[model samples]
Every structure is written in C-alpha cells, then in structure tokens.
Target: MKLSHIKLYPLAIPLIEPIKMSGETITHANTLLVYLKTNTGKEAWGETSAAPLMTGETLGGLLQNAKYLGEHLRGLDITELNSISMVLGKILYGNTSVKSCFEMAIIDLFAQAQDTSVWQILRDLSKNKTQTKPIPLPLLRMLGGSLDKEVADAALYRAQGYRHWKIKVGSLPLAEDLERVSILCDLLAGDIVSADANGAFNLDQAVIFCTAEKTRQLSFVEQAIAAKSTIDDFSLLKSKSHLPIALDESIHDVNEIKYFDQANALDGASLKLIKTGGLVSGLAAALELQRRNLKINLACKVAETSLSAAATASLGFAIDSIPWGFSMSNQYLEFDICAKPLHAENGHLNIEQLNPIGIGVTPEINLVTQAHSKEYSTVLC
Candidate 1:
C-alpha cells in the first residue's frame, strides 16, 4: 500500500512520583507519538522519548528528522522500510530515535495490513532457527539510584513481587556504590539484581567496581564505560571482573555488533528498539548476539509512555532469546495516559490478543492538559 500521510503528537506524561537516578530526580516524561496512514486505510502508531544526556539527540531534533522522513516517505510503498532506512541513514548522520519511531510505525502498518500481531510475524521469522520455546515476559523493576531513598524504593519493589531489579550505579564513588549494593543485596536477598553505570566508569574503575564484593550481588553490569571508547578497555575489564557484562551504548546498530563480538567485549547486550532503529534491526542484533551465545536485554529510556511500552512488550515476546527491561511497570507509578494500563502481575507481563493493532495504544488527549512541558528534550538517541 502507498503511504499517505504522517502525523506527530508531542505529549508529556507526569511520573506518579519523582524517580531518582544517578543524582538526578525526574518528575515527568516527554514522548513523541508518530502516526502513519496508508492509502489502504490502514494506520499504525509508534512512540519515542528524547534523552539528550545519553544519546545526544533532543525532541526538536527528533521532530525535524521526523518531518524530513515524513516528506521522503510520502507516496512511497510501505513495504520498503529497509530500503527507506538505508536511504535515510545515508542522508542523516545519526538519529536512531527518529528512525526507530518511523520504523515501528512501518511495522505497525505492515502488521495491520497482514491482519496479524507483530509477535506472530517474529515467530514465523524465527521458527526454523532455534529450538528454544518462547519464554514468558517479565516485569522489570528499576532500582533508581544508590541513595537511601533508592534502598527504600528497592525494598518496596521486592515487597510487590518483583523478581528482577535493574540498579543504577557508577555515578557514586566506588566505596559508596559498593555500600549501596551491599545494603540492597541484604534487603532483597533472593531477588535478581543488575547494575547499570550509564557509561560512567572507565576500564580500571569498572574492574575495581565489578571485582568488589558488592558487585558479586549483581547478575550483570551494564555500560560501565562510554560506547565510543574502545572495546579493548571493556575486554580488559571483563577479563578481570570475571562477571557477566552487558553493553548498552556500545552496540548502536546491527552492523556494530560484530565489533563487540570480535573484541569479546561483553557477556550480553542491551537492545533498545530505538537504539537499533526498530523491531527488524533490533531482532537482527539479538539474533547475532544469540549466534555468539550472548544474552539480550530489551531496555528502554525513562521518557517512554504506554504506547512505547506496548511496542516494547511486543518485541520482548517476539525474541524469547533474552530477558527484557519493560520498566513501564515501575515508571508508570502515576496514572497512565493510555486507555489500557500496562501493569505487571506477579512480576510478569502478558501481551494482549490483537485488538487495536500496532502499538495497541490510544492516548487520552484530555489528560495532555495535565502534563508538564517545562523540561526540554535531551539528545539520547
């Protein structure tokens, strides 16, 4: 079907309560919603949030890129998403968020046209490759920061039946970070814990932190150093730590996965749909990681909404090869803007049977009036 029009909606969803991470407290989230319409009367939806601190792309930049993409997308065939991505990639230097938003919209469109769920499409693609069965998706508990409040927050999450927790570390002094982890480990003794440094530590520091007794409490460590830095440092640190390491910012696209594989830089990789540009690319990266016997973690930025969360859930179930970080259960502590809530039950999230195809979300425009827009979008592509 021919693409007809594209529309963008900018919305800000307030956090139920402020979330503290790496010394910063977040009060609200800003997300951009993209709508794609086809001549066949099929429509699909996609969502993305701007995170400048991590990715270096802002909301304004995302909007500009979306507008440019919309222009190029007009009248084109909907089935040519991969080709479109290649063409767009050549023109735009880097804007994974933009590409991701559009790519998901395309997927949604395709799924709607085929009258099937996204997961079904993914299953068909993977049927011949692996013997593993699709594992149930789990609700991700995010341990905000290494503060007193963070400890309290983690305890509350444990009380709520969350089995897995992703802790934000690396911003603290090594001693303090270790102390916090020790406290958390003691508090949530049986829970699975993971640590994310957000690229704040170098090789030496990562080694020291990972080798520390406190880190032994974690299932894995994430992005200890910046992705732009050489993987040699990661390899060296990984060799010494002897603990599982998951690279986040390090693997930007499917092609870049080979570099990490060659360096043997990490034990697992955090594949964000936005970071890989969409489900297709994200799946390609996950499959490549699987080929090397590496694990995968589906993660998201803080600014995502239920629409984005649902899209993530679809992808999570599609690739049963790894654990996923659908942190929406933790982030949506406040009321959700979507008509249907993406809540977790017994630390697990189940995908709904097809109803509203493609992202399966409809934003409540009335609630947008209550949203705060003071925060400017950061570039976190």
Candidate 2:
C-alpha cells in the first residue's frame, strides 16, 4: 500500500515518578507521536522520546525532523521497510530518535499490510540460525525513585514474581549510591539485578562503587563512566571492578562494540530502538552482540507510552535470548496514548496474546492530540 498521509504530535505525558539517573531527571515522556495512513486506509502509530543527554534529541528537534521525513516519505510504499529507514538515515544526519519513530510507523503499517507481526520482519532480517524457544520475557523494573518508594515497590513486585531489577545510580554521591545499591541488593537478593550509572561515574568513583562489598552482589553494572571517557579508562574501570560491566552509551555501532570487547572494557550492552536507528538496525545490532557472546538488554528510553513499548516488545521476539531482560516503559506513564495500551502482567510480557496482528496495538488519536507538549503542524504529508 502506498503511504497516503503522515502526522506528527509532540507529546509530554507525565511520569508517575521522575526517572532519576546520573545527571538526568525525566519527569515526563516528551516525545513525537507519528500517525500514519496508507492509501488502503490502514492507520498505524509510532513514537520516540526526547533524550537530550543520552541521544542528543529534544522534543522540538524530534517534531521538526519527523515532520520533514513524513513529508518526504508521503508517496513511498510502507512495504519497503528497509529502504524507508535507509532513506531517512541518508536524508537526515543524526536524529536517530526521529528516524526510529518513522521506522516504527512504516514497519507497523507494513506488518499490518502483510497480516503478520512486526517481529516476523526483524526475525527475517536476523542472520542467527540458532533455534529460539518461545518463552515470556521478564520485565526489568526501575528502582530509580526515592529509597523508600523503591524498597516498597521492590517488595510488591517481588511478591508478584518479579525477579529482574535495575537501580538508577550516578545521580547521588558515590558512597551514598553505593550504600543505596547495597541496601537494594540485599533486599533483592537472588534476583537478577544490575545498576545503571548512565555514564555518571568518574573512573575512580566507578571503581570504588563496584569494589564495594555490598555492590559486588550486583549481577552487573552498566555505563559507569562517561561516553567521552577513553576506552582505556573503561578497561581500567572494568579491571578494577569486581562485577561484570556493560556499556549502553559507549557502544552505539557494531564497531564500537567490537572495540570495547577487544579492549576488554564491557561484558554486555543495552539496546534501544532509538539508539540503533530502527527496529531492523536494532535487530542487527542485537544479532552481532549475541554472536560475540555479549549480554543483550532490550530497552526503551526513560519514559514512553505503550505505543513505543509495544514496538520494543514486538522486537524482543526476534532475539534468541534476552538474559539482560526487556525494559518496556509504559507502566511509568500517568497517561497512555490509547485506552488499550500494551503492558506486561506478572513481570512478564506475552507479545502474541497482546496483539495478534501487525504490531498488535493501536492508539487513540483523540487522546494523543490533547497530550501535545509543543504546538506543531499536524499537516497531512
């Protein structure tokens, strides 16, 4: 089906609690929501969040870039999944978040046109020949809020069979963060738990935190030092720390992953659709990580509605293993793009049952229209 229309909505859905991490506090999911219509009258939705520190994309930038791509891609066929992303990449330099949202829209529409699921597209793109057993992926919740609230949430989620956990460190002082991690690790004993510094640590502080006796119980530590920090710095930190180290911001492309691996600086990485340019690219990166025996954590940005969460969950099915866990972020939102938003229950996400067609979810445009964070043209592309 030919692409007939495109619309961009800049949204700022409030978060239940601020997602506090190293050097950042995101209280709302400032994002661009793309509403697409095909010549056949098929409609689909896609979204991307504003992560200035992580991805260097703001809401204003997301709105403008998405609008431009939508206009340029007006007459293209949504069936050309790979070409659409390539075109966006070539036309625009580095608004990966915007490109990701556009890719999500096209892929969602493409899968719907084929009467199949989005994962089928990514699975075909994957080069891995390993057989995959269909199992429900565990949800990794954030423990980044206040200490009392985090502890309370941990107990509640643990009772509900939640096992995977990630603590938001790098915001508070090093010793305090270490003590806090120690407390949570003790509370979450026997759980697959990790701490994300969000590139907040200096090499010395990171080594100190990782070497602390309490933090040693952690399953792994992620992006401890800054992205600007040298690979040798990461190697030093990795060697000094007692637990395994993973890189999120530091490893954007496959070459970086290989470089870090050769430098012996990381054990795993966090993969996001926005970071990798699109779902197809994200799957390719995941396959590379898997081939090299690196841990793969499929995640969304800080705060996003289920539209992006559904996209993330859909992509999770193509990967052979997700030992690091899936980070679907819709649960953090105070509002959703639609009444029937996708979500995980009992700490696990079952993708097929959630949406049997395409990406299996749709958004309520009426609600999304009112959730605008900034005024932008909803002009038909």
Best by lDDT: 2
Show pairs that collide, candidate 1. 16-334, 51-379, 51-380, 52-378, 52-379, 55-380, 55-381, 56-379, 57-379
C-alpha lDDT of all candidate models, in order: 0.70, 0.82
Instruction: Give the TM-scores of the predictions, in the order they appear.
Output: 0.89, 0.95
Once fitted onto the true fold, the runs of candidate 1 whose alpha carbons sit more than 4 angstroms away are 23-25, 80-84, 87-93, 128-134, 145-147, 353-356, 368-381
For 221-337, candidate 1 gives per-residue lDDT tens digits of 888887768767877877888568888877877677787777877888887776887777777787788788887777767757666776776767776645535555325536656
Q: Considering every candidate listed, which one attains the maximal TM-score?
A: 2
Model 2 per-residue lDDT at 249: 87
Could you tell me how far off, in angstroms, the CA of residue 86 lies in candidate 2 after the best superposition?
A: 2.1
lDDT of 2 by residue, 308-352 (tens): 888887778777478989888888888888778766678888765
